[model samples]
Target: MTCGLFQILMISFFHLIELSSQQETRFVYETFRGQENLYLDGSATVLPSGLLQLTNALHHQMAHVFYKESIGLSSSRQLSFSTHFVCALVPQPGVEGGHGMAFVVSPSMDFSHAESTRYLGIFNVSKNGSPSSHVLAVELDTIWNPDFEDIDHNHVGIDVNSPLSVGIASASYYSDIKGKNESINLLSGNPLQVWVDYEGNMLNVSMAPCEVQKPSRPLLSQHINLSDIFPNRRLFVGFSAATGTAISYHYILSWSFSTSRGSLQRLDISRLPEVPHPRSEHKNLSPLFIVLLGFLAIMGFCTLTGMYFFRRSKYAEVTEAWEEEFGAHRFSYKSLYKATKGLTRMDFLEEEVLEKSTEEISFQTEK
Candidate 1:
């Protein structure tokens, strides 16, 4: 009986090793230079330095990026998983940037039914809230999507099967020193790190500047079960990004993921690629330019006004006492001045002579 029990114990130990090996999923792409294991579609591309760029500076576009191999999610028990990625969202300067990117985990990479724009290329309008979709996402949304009932224009959300979030919070990070939440703008055009971990039916999402270490307190901590999303299959982890009328370039500088809590590799900040800074879109008129324009406008108005009054003044007549003897036949000097057009006074004498001659002829005929 002792020998039989020993053999069974040995068998059980080997079986445990096999399951552990299968459950272990680890990958690191500090830079994607020569790696081809990533499956990119639509607008996704791997830059020269292994930077994963999803969606271009163009609008109304979508992209998907996924790891070639799938990671198994155990059905018998809830497994632990952690992933961290550094991303930089460089938006077109001087314009509102839309729709953002999401770290997605899906059982199937065939996003044929998905639509771009506010959907983040994950699902279409018709399937956004369907109960069967089992899509898990951590979205860093820049545009306010009223359709999804988004809380604000800039927020991070935990979504299941829909862009509409189960839990949402404005983009922010908890500062240990300040002991409060500090707001973060997702479109700030700076490289930032996002960490997601799921263990014991709890999902925690945290973010911080690339230079700072992970904070003790996460930005979001909510209960979630991965087993419920994918009951008996492996899931592919990747990113989905889309742009609407507003455009932004979404880039993943570095990424690392593992199904084990402490074994997940840390992203090397020093070796990571630099974020592309956006140009200053809010153009301000130079004070000198404004002053110059104002000076020119004032000078133009003053010069024209002065010239107008001066010309009118030249036609001003005092109406001497002798002028009233003509009664109704009297013409005002201003009328004659206007008829002369401010020049050629000699022509006025000839014009008056012709008029007097005609008047005399008419008077003689009447007599």
Candidate 2:
């Protein structure tokens, strides 16, 4: 009876463990906007001149997708989105100036923001008072703004509603004195990649020199509740670039997203056809080592299970032997009273004293 009960409990526990391993459902959409094709082969070139801008406009809008009435992104669910771009500025003689780039998420998807020169990628508010109409942009700006030019070349900014509010919030000193305040170095084409994460009420942004390396801790964090900007719980995400007639090219190699409960899904990063880059080289353990570890783990689990069963079996055996020898029906109130010589408290005390004396005698004999 004990063995049967133990087996049933073990089976029930294992079934619950299996149920927790089910995969979660996740959905993803990706679009690339630019003049050149973004590819995986690491061959896409950044425009030396003309500006390129790509907007999701008609393909996939955020408001149409993630909402309580749409995809049902409630408090219990979470969503993650990220994109990768390669920005390189080739030497352009006396024309050293280059435009910066931005990643934007806003409530409105219909209207195109006005061009604000270097700030064109960010929202440009109309003359009317509608700052609360929509919120847009976290910019990785390279150029310096006099209003917030406390630092040097590479800087980060957050823009909302209009270009008037578009200025640097965080800036990194330029590596070279000549490169100070310039968004891109015209001589050497150095590439930069940025990553953004928004979960619950928090927003985080990070940047990496290459796609293979781990992203640095968020450069900036804001406490604004995402529910405010995305009241409907959906946001349109895309990139925008412009050059004020100063030509240049922009390219996005890849983009992807994952939900709080789901696995990562690949994103389409190019409107033009291009070859994919080779996978990044990183140290990972061999599959054989993983299999060996799994085998050892299984063996350890079995050993522990066997020990438990053996101990349980021993306890059951002892109990069964006691029941057989004593006979469950044999022990009665009269038998107990006779064993103690009388139904008196003094008789019971004397019986305990005799048991102690017998144990001492047995111990002395063994020694």
Candidate 3:
């Protein structure tokens, strides 16, 4: 009856949920790339330093590079990618830096109309905020874009088909010890990593230094559907950057991409060089410290052994003393029987009568 119908409905609902979860876990495309697969344009080059340089410190320059194929992005699917990159602003005398770089997905690989500066070389000024641009970007912005009403000069932002970020978070890392966000200079020439994920109509962006672990909390996350903007579901994936009067070097050391219809996997860090650290600033334990540690270890062992033997010897001495004192007083059963008088009723009565007669005679004599 009604209960049966309700049960059927519940079963259908659970099945739908299970299907959704399965779709979310699937990846349609998954691959990794190094410098060889990255196609560079404009000022971008494969540096001898093993980084795919997107832009040099030249003024009013724009560079856009993308992979050779068109990636599919569907409404029901999750798409994710990560980039290991570094951007360093080259300070010049009395010159201002324009903008930073972006991980972008666009309709085509052509950047002929893409402008530099605040546009990040992905969109021109005319189409910067237009809905028809058909572009999705995660920006690592260095300079503030006043016209766009940016939250801060340095931040991570999620952009959908426009330069305006639907959501933004100041570029920072999660400090596990502090349990809070710790700001870092993005233009400090340090290698950084960023993850971009689009799942169930939400776009999430997370960033941190290469030396630091990836923060669980995404810097910027927003709800958006790519199907609305990208009807064809095919798009070009790559990076873009621009320099205004100010300049910087933009590089991508490695990149990994995956789609929701495939297995979830982490970015392959082995293909890239380890993040650079200063050797001179590094410190290790001194020889004196090692010697002290060894001495303390030996002393601790000796103390433990001494305490163990001391307690054992003390216990043995107590046991021996107890046995010696108790063993010496043990007497035979015959001596105990004499102390209590023999178990004979007639002898006990005769002894008692004799004592009474003696007592009576003594009393008469006294009288």
Each model's C-alpha lDDT?
0.87, 0.46, 0.70
Candidate 3 Cα RMSD (Å): 23.6
Predicted structure 2: lDDT: 0.46
Best by lDDT: 1
Stretches of candidate 1 exceeding 4 Å from the true structure: 1-21, 278-288, 294-367
In candidate 3, which residue ranges exceed 4 Å CA deviation? 1-36, 74-98, 261-367
TM-score of each: 0.75, 0.45, 0.61
Give candidate 3's total backbone clashes.
Answer: 7
Name the better of 2 and 3 by TM-score: 3
Arranged by TM-score with the best first, the candidates are 1, 3, 2
- The collision pairs in model 1 are 32-50
Per-candidate total of colliding backbone pairs: 1, 11, 7
Per-residue error (Å), model 3, residue 198 = 1.3
CA shift of 360, model 2, Å = 99
